[model samples]
Structures are given as C-alpha cells and as structure tokens.
Target: MSDVFSGVYEINSPDVVSEYFEDQAVILNLATGHYYSLGGIAGSLWGLLIGGHATDAILENLAAQQPQLVEGASAFVAELISFGLIRQARAGAPGMSIDVAWTSEAPKLEVFEDLAELIAADPVHDVDLEAGWPVLRPQS
Candidate 1:
C-alpha cells in the first residue's frame, strides 16, 4: 500500500457518521461504538478533507502559508487515518474549489469511549415500544 499521502480522501461512510457544528465536529464510528471530537485546526482540516480537497493540495497550501504547521498537520492526518475515519479518494472524484484558512493553533482530536454502550444500543429493534428508542426492551 502507498503511504505517500498525495491523494484526495473521503470519509469512511456507512459505519462512520460525523457532524460539523460551527467550529467543531463530532465523529462516531458505529463499528467500534467510539466517537471523536475535533476542534480548532483539526476541525478545519476535516472540513477540507470531507470537502474533497486533495491531501497533498491541503498540505502544500498549508506549507506555503504557515510552513511551521506542516508537521502538525501531517500528524493530524496520520491520526485521522489511524482512527479509520478517512480513506483515499476514488479515481476521477471531484475536488472542492473552496479555500481553507487554518487557525494558528495545532490540530486536536479528542476521542470519547464513554458512550460506547449507549451508541452500541440498537434503537430500532432493541427498544420497548412503550418507552420508545434508547429504552431497551426487557430481556425474557
């Protein structure tokens, strides 16, 4: 496998769900029942990544503007990859045209495991009709 980090990337979907609210983002991996939060530079980078900007393009632009943040940005990307939240973009994928303005602060990824059991709960079939979702049916 290639580790050059020179291609566009996309969200690992189906099992992963994410929402960006204002300056922050919340990402949940349904497969593992773990969630993550991103703020500051990390959120901005995630916005760009999901927006279809090429990894190399983002890094190059950041390097041209900030220079010092290249290392941190790369590490952030690596961390995202390690978390299985993103994957390389498919061929002929359309790219985003918008520009990304990153903050001076380093990127940060906050992982949360407190909600694993809650997230893993099956709201569809495991719920009591009287209590509705989030209320598991009593085991017989």
Candidate 2:
C-alpha cells in the first residue's frame, strides 16, 4: 500500500442522497439523475465510508476481515468519486472502522440511466401547469 489513500470522505450533499436497504444501497445523484445500486460488500463499504472513517483505517479494517477486499477497496472508492457521489472531506471526522462480516464477494457499483431524464426533471417547476404536478415535461 505505497499510495496509501488517507483522509475521510463525505457524501456529495445537497445533490446526492443514499439509503441502505437489506443488503443494498440506493444512491441517487439529483444533479445527474443517475442512481446507483451497491449490494453486499459494496454496500457495507459505503456505510463505512460515510461513517467518516479515514481511508487508511477503512482499508486496514477491511483487510483484517477479508484480506482479498483490500485489493478492490481503492477502485471501489475511486468509482464512488468518479460518480460524483462522494469527495474527500476537507476536515476528517473521527469514526469507527468497517464492522461487517468478511466476505469474498467483489465490490461493485451498478449504475442505472433508465430514469435519468425523469428523475432530473423538476417536479415542482418543470411540470406542465395544465397537466398538473406529477405530469412532467416529456424527455427532450
């Protein structure tokens, strides 16, 4: 781990919102309207990231639980950064490390663009006055 990624991270707020359900995490980037699904190990990793744990601490914790996952941790966090869902926090917060049980599953970030246009549309301002609040303008 030469390039030991340091610092904690925070979700891109005011534009991104995420919720974890069961073993999956649903993250929506309102500005882009591209939602992502992260399940299993990826979902658990996300929880840890948002928990404000330092990257090095997170990797160390995950590696302790599942040595194999450390190899993918950097890429997983990179993917999250590329998607504009999270960014390195200016001031790191003190937090706990990963707590999920070890697993061999490879972390993944599943992206969906099916409802991008609709999701990005402003329901309160982009709706047709005659058609009502729920009726949004057709995809352009």
Candidate 3:
C-alpha cells in the first residue's frame, strides 16, 4: 500500500488506450506499441482503477468480492505500472475514464509482447517546432 501510486494512479497518456468487451479488456500502449489483454475480475478492477478510484478503495472493493484475488491483484497492478499503463496521478490530473461492465470471477492481467510492431502507429506530436507551423501549401 506504500507504493508511490497509493495516492493516485492515472493511465499513461499518448501511450495507452483500452477497450473493454463486457468484463474483458484490451489495452494498447502506443509508445511501445504493446497491447495487453485483461479479463475476469481483474478487468473489472481495471475499470474502477481507471475510473478514478484510489488504489486502496479498488483493492478493498475487489478483495471483498473475491478474497482469493487479494494476492494477485497487487501483482497485476504492479505489472500495469511496469508496463507504463498506470502511474501516480499528478495533482488535478485526470485519470482514465471508461465504461466498464463489472464482473466478479477472478483477477488477471495478461500482456502480449509479440504484437507491438504489428499494431499500427499512433503519432502524437507537436504542431510547431522551434518557430511557426511549416507551410503546407499545395503544389501551385
């Protein structure tokens, strides 16, 4: 509970995206191009975590629903942190918000390492460099 994120955790931006199907989920880290799949009660916890629940509350709620998950949930959360999917929320910085259909089975967060290169690029960038916008005049 003393982890840096105990205060708050937000999804790493410009780097991650998540989609859920019922209680299952697919998460993509655009920067690394690595996508993750989560399901069971773990996916449900993800929804709460991203929805702005502090770590303690999420763990408490989920652990109450599925006592066996008390051990794995922490590990899974650590994985999320290591994968750069979630991090300490900065003051007033909004965390991820998603529509999650809750489930109460078990907890698990899976990573697919081979698909990074295949996932199409998400180019997040600055419009202006050192000075002004580069002219995009059409050929004429």
Candidate 4:
C-alpha cells in the first residue's frame, strides 16, 4: 500500500502508453485493453512516478509544492496501484527529477475503469468476416 509511495515504482508493461493533456493524462494498457484517465494532481504524480522518483521523495516534493496534496496522496497512489498502472521495484529507481511542471490545483484521482469491456475483444481476431471491424461481440 504505502510501499507504492515509500519505495520505487515503474511501469512494468511495455504495452502501456500514456498521453498527457493540460493537467490530465490518458493511459492505455494494450495487453489488458484497458484505458485510464488521470486528472488533476494525479497527472503530475504519474509523470514523477514513471520518471523513477522514489515514493518518499515524490511525497516530499508534492508536500513542498502543494501542501494540500499531502493529505490524500497516499490514497491516490493506492488507486494507481489497484489500477495496475504502477508496480514496486526491487531497488529504488534512479532519475529522480521532482521538478514536475504544472500549476497547483486540488488533488484528486479519477480512474475511468470502463474501457476493459470495450477493448477486451480483439477486432482482428474476433470480428465476423461479414461484419468486418467495429463488430466484435463482447467477451464474456
């Protein structure tokens, strides 16, 4: 739990892709076919965590920059954990750059977990030859 913040975490899957917006981000898990949208301060935290900053260090930086975040950072990171967006590493990861860019805003972790069912079926393999693409029958 707290280990997600006390130690080091990294994106363990090569299939994961992230796209950032102004203060939000969308992460896609190609393998699981699940997409996630991270908004508010959760976006900033995602960049730092993936950049290899240790848990405590990121918390320190977040606390220093946005004291308001200190209260809920743990729960947010836990959410990231449950979503499988981040994983603990055997050793502390390097590349600790805490100078994350962005204006301070209220911190909240909003995870959109409704994409799995939409993407779990393989279009290329599961679609009917007559129906073509965009015609997958949802996997059960």
Highest TM-score: give the candidate number. Answer: 2
Deviation of model 3 at 109, angstroms: 1.7
Best by lDDT: 2
Model 3: what TM-score? Answer: 0.69
Instruction: Point out the higher-scoring one by TM-score: 2 or 3.
Output: 2
What lDDT tens digits, residue by residue, belong to model 4 across residues 1-140? 23445888887577677888765788887768778777677777788777777878888777777777665777777877887878887776666567864457655665455667557667778876787776765456
lDDT string for model 2 (1-140, tens) is 51646788889998999997776899999999899998658887788788787888888777877787787877888889888898888887766535668677888889999888778888888887789866786557
Give the Å shift of residue 80 in candidate 4: 0.7
Worst 10 residues of 4 by lDDT: 101-110
lDDT of 1: 0.81
* Model 1 residue 117 distance off true place after TM-score fit, in angstroms: 1.5
Sort the candidates on lDDT, descending order.
Answer: 2, 1, 4, 3
State each model's CA lDDT, in order: 0.81, 0.82, 0.66, 0.72
Give me candidate 1's TM-score against the actual structure: 0.81
Residue 118 accuracy (lDDT) in model 2: 76
Residue-level lDDT tens digits of model 3 in 26-115:
899888867888877677767667767777666655555566665677778888988889877764323434343345556777777675
What's the lDDT for candidate 2?
0.82
